[model samples]
Target chain A: MTRVAQISCGTEYSGIQWLLSDIAERVGIELVYPEMALSRIDAACKEIGLRAESPSLNMMMARAVSTLADPTIKGALLLTCFKCSEGTIVKDTIRRYLSDRSDMPIISYSNVEKPKEIELYARLEALATLITRKALLMREKQEGITMGIDSGSSTTKVVVMKDDEIVGEGWLPTTDPLKSVDKGIEDALNGAGLKEKEVEAIGVTGHGRELVSKHVNADLNLEEVSVVAKGTALLSKRHKGDATVIDIGGMNNKLILTRDGIANSFSLGGICGGSSGRFLEVASHRLDVDISELGQLALKSTERHELQSYCMVFGIQSLVVSLASGVKREDVAAAACRSVANQVYENQIQEMEMRPPITFVGGVSLIEGVKKEFEEMLGVDIIVPPNSQYAGAVGIATLVSGI
Target chain B: MKILVYPPNSLILADLVERAGHEAVVLMREIGEHVRDAEIDAPPINVTEDDLKRALRYVSVEEPAGLKGRIGLLTPLLDKAEASVILSDAPPTYGCMGCAVADEFFKFLIRQRKIPTLEIKYEGKEKLEETVKGIMEFLVQLPKEGEISEKKG
Candidate 1:
């Protein structure tokens, strides 16, 4: 009998475990439940019926392969479910564990099917073959290239993704809303190293979607709300769960609520510039400082002031008045962060009935101080992903890999 | 327990109010004729000079019922109203502020006399709920509308 060890994370005694158990049950292989997995190998070893001799990372792998050393035992498999973040990391980690060992074939896979009826035996049988050789790309070749150009009043963003990895992405200040979109699209295609003929379809979004569609042909044109929601869903799929996305653009803001992978509702801001990016830009000009270091300066604020007004005009006036009253400039900048957060909370979040794991994006996400204000008010941890500013582009690029 | 809200004829606002567990009676002036053609609820109320005295809890163009007409009919209804609330959308339209009528009526209801209340800008249902909750909290201490006396110099 071939000893097969299958490990599931965050799914123990849950839906996934039951599915794996059913699969193992049908395959006629006795399962050695490790109970819990502190690390990837531990879980693998337990499911394979091995003694926990030495739990070190290297030792664990050695034992895993040695147990599989017998020709009777064929391979190993790592299983993940839809919307499982830890599963992705753990699956990769375990794959790395058995990568060099040719004797024990190991493969990682995820199932979005209902848990009650998982075909573990058939899946593992197929995985067994894939492990021995390179898996051929079964997907069809590019029929044509499709593009999603997102142009706002202030910024232009373009993304082209194939097979769900970022193939090409571009961003530029929207000097000319109409023309910059075309330029951004060209830049994105060049970065991807693909020609316009390769594109299959085109999608346009943002306030200028209509204008863009008028300029360049598109397969589909969606509102900024739909485009952003679609983009956010693609990015958050790797780490699943309900997430409130706060996009703080230069001149406006957007609050999107997503659950399981679908956007439930969304709200966008008006043409107010009190939000962080535009605020910092204007503040830097008034204070004669660099915008990049504004976050660090705000951190050194000796005193904090409250900006009470919601109107941008009144807010600017209030800032000037406070500065004239001898308030430290750093403190004044800090107050702007507070004001932005308050506006987000009062107008965007609380008004829209948003929930957390709130992900803050947009160009201003680079500013640490503004993020801190959000964390403070929401009283929950805020997650800012890598390439925070380029998330829109990254989201668009990820579309190629997804169905 | 029953409160009517008029928002700036924006479906987005009605959607927000519905999400907040409130019965939002949307009054849309533009589509009133179509709604009338469909022959639903009470005939479309007509906008008139008398709507100035009414205090609305919410106002928006999202409601298919004529905003002006509804306000005109509600002037007397507001007199019998236990309480009311109003929120205006961005770039407040003349109808939102009851500008087609007299300004003194709004001043009396919102500022000086404070009969009901009027809030300019996006007075979303979230704020409306907060106001409702506040009123509920003060219910025990509130004097009867007629029994309570306004301070006079």
Candidate 2:
């Protein structure tokens, strides 16, 4: 069945196109590419003597309209970038065209370098849910909840899952991994309204996984990378395809390239305070701003002041000097975000052929500024899944559910 | 009195020195300036032509070329100090471990100047407190004005 038609600019970054394809595959939807739809639209427009103001926008509109004509195509998704001025100019025209012709569910999203993955996923999930609800009604409900625990170097995440859906989740800073894991598990269990004995199984992952496993008697003790891959794949299953996953945690950053549903290749940042969560936290402390507010503040920047060094100590000093020289806080914050993005790109991404539908996960993915910087630098729409910081935990939960 | 602390990047030592009401002159302050203003393309260390040339003399005993540069960078800071606090067992902190050669040179320079020095071993919490207190007491008892006490016993 024709699941959905994806309309996008021909010049859209290859990574994003790959992601769209992946999402379509995951959701078991057929995607009619713009090229195929454009040919039909071009022929029709020629016959009707219609002239489009912007060729790309015209093509996108034509493709969307033509694809939706097929009764099998349940939904239409229009993908455009923030930098596409032509798309912006003709947005209303396309909206009018869709509203006038198509009764099917349609979603129009403007892609940017840094997009909130959670919000985008929610919208995508809603659309998928809308299209697949009837089919879903025939499936059997999953029994009992399973617990997944991630005891990372900096934070502990616990998730309780009932089949494919997350039932309860909790996260806490990891002062002592053992204590933090216990607390996180307790909190998650409490939220799920279950006792320890009620949980069918428990799985664990992260830097402190072994430490946690030694103390917590988990059914499965999975490697951090494998679990992360599983979690990313599960969350993004609605969009089945390959993506480069960038996970920046407290002490380290991991770059995993997923092909189909498996990890094809991966690289890790060295043991330095240069491109991890610690760097951002230290920068936040030096700036006297809460880390949570850094991204929004960065969005307000009119100009960016790039950090001269990648080292956290040096970066903090540059920040101090920038503040002293009357530079706006937002600009400095934006610059700091850019520096981190640059470090990750230069040190890791540069060495790898990063395919798109790139997903950013882990604690640092929560930072909007970092996401924005990654998007801008990578020149693609980056997808951040919901509860990104708990991706490893979620992955472990998904793994144990299968058993 | 200005007290030069070894492993110049120790923020804890810098904070303690300030708390004790004495100028804490550490090499990291100078290094930090370079790191902060360094151009995006510049190396981590901001080594000038003069610094490289001056550092060349110390290259013999210091096998690594970077250590000589660090020694040259720290010489001026060491020269201006009236006293020295050598953190014997303190682990190297961020931006502080440029060159082991420079660390050895720093000690030699302090001895050549016959500056009032206190060597403290940073072990446990209680010992660290005792060491800090000892340094503070030593700073307080140092002779006033231009009289540099001849290497206190």
Candidate 3:
């Protein structure tokens, strides 16, 4: 069993001590509680120099620091009761410290005295996936023909990759994902000038993945975090050691931080599609331009217009108000892009300490206006790698190639 | 007789449901089996491979992966629920499991479920006894025996 350090306070009293260890051990992970060094506790606290009062809380932090010293440990599980305000602060501190100091993946949980079993299971499962699947996430190249279907909410994207390069691709609106992937993959296969028999493996990802995977018989099925990280690694070699990926999709957004091509930490959220590709699609349609024309149209405008930048509905209302007031279509498009970029920055980007070189992927990434806004916000050129819109499909396909 | 306690995972809510003559369909009931089952080997996650595949019909893929895994495990209980006791504004501590993302989304599914539901906000722990009393009252009102007998008959 792979061992991960268990760094926490109050598990003994919470009645979940056995359950936590049981869950970890059950998942082929032995919880590595730092060997008791009662004398070393104060010294460990002094080393980090955090001024926290609770002895156990201090010890939890110290144990966290000590876990960093152990090479046998593959990952860390930090736990604290929901009532422990001090524990929460220390938990975040240790998480940041461990992340900044080492490549060990970390997950934290706030539990009640008798925390539910499923919650623990899910958290541990996610942690296990990070450890057990590291090789797949860190894979640098593709070996054979692999088809990846990214069943995103707004679009179904499919890609056919031969060896290490993309041969054919498909993109279409996603209404019924199970049905969409059939035609989508067919189009890609047709473009590749190959029969279905030539394809070796299939990988499915994104929200529509399970439905499509069932339809297409996928060999590799994974969530977007690791898949996107792998896809970005292939697209750009600039930050092979440490990098960040931004993917704003139809309904939500993903901000992923990667170390050595494996996603170490990520923030997944995009409330109301306010800061996503859908907003741009809606605004572009309103402006009587194709979604593909939005980026250039936004670039053409010099006038700065403000739209409600938080909620999608409010943003659309602002869009209506701007058009009613005779704002140029180009200007309105620019405002929409700016609004999306700003919301993404606020909601997702700010969640991680973005380590560059940052690669932008997803349908929204193709919009030069969104790219410019992100570049302006970060003051660094955001690389929208070749075929950025097909990131999920490319990601899944590349991963499936290994199998 | 199945009362799904909203913001699930509360021993107290489950107990209240029991006191009101109903079995509480809960996260603990659903996930606990997978976790503690001796036959289910180590790396014992709640959502099995099949469970995740089946859950796709319930929640969208766009949800956080955690949410998807949870919705899968929790929905079976949701489907069995004849009633639900929903708690709001209470910090999800010491129980009130359903009140917590996976927490929000699962509770949302229960809310949307076509079942008799009672919504209550926890004033505070000092008032928890009163809150429990209110929850007990709602659980009692559920058509437990009558509905089951009617369907059976």
Candidate 2, residue A2: Cα displacement in angstroms equals: 42
| 1 versus 2: better lDDT goes to | 2
TM-score of 2: 0.48
Computed on C-alphas against the true complex, the DockQ of each candidate is 0.01, 0.01, 0.02
Per-residue CA lDDT of candidate 1, range A262-314, in tens? 34345555535776467767766665667667667677788768866755668
Ranking by lDDT: 3, 2, 1
Q: What is the lDDT for A239 in model 3?
A: 32
RMSD of 1: 22.9
User: Residue-wise lDDT of candidate 3 within A213-298, one digit each (tens)?
Assistant: 77787898887777887788787754368888998877778787888777786666633578778888888888889989999999
Give the TM-score (vs. native) of candidate 3: 0.64
Give the fraction of reference interface contacts each candidate recovers. Answer: 0.00, 0.00, 0.00
Measured over all alpha carbons after superposition, the RMSD of each candidate to the real structure, in angstroms, is: 22.9, 26.5, 13.1
Per-residue lDDT of model 3, residues B20-78, tens digit only: 88888877767777778776542334345455455678866454333344566777887
Candidate 2 whole-model C-alpha lDDT, 0 to 1? 0.68
lDDT values for all models: 0.52, 0.68, 0.76
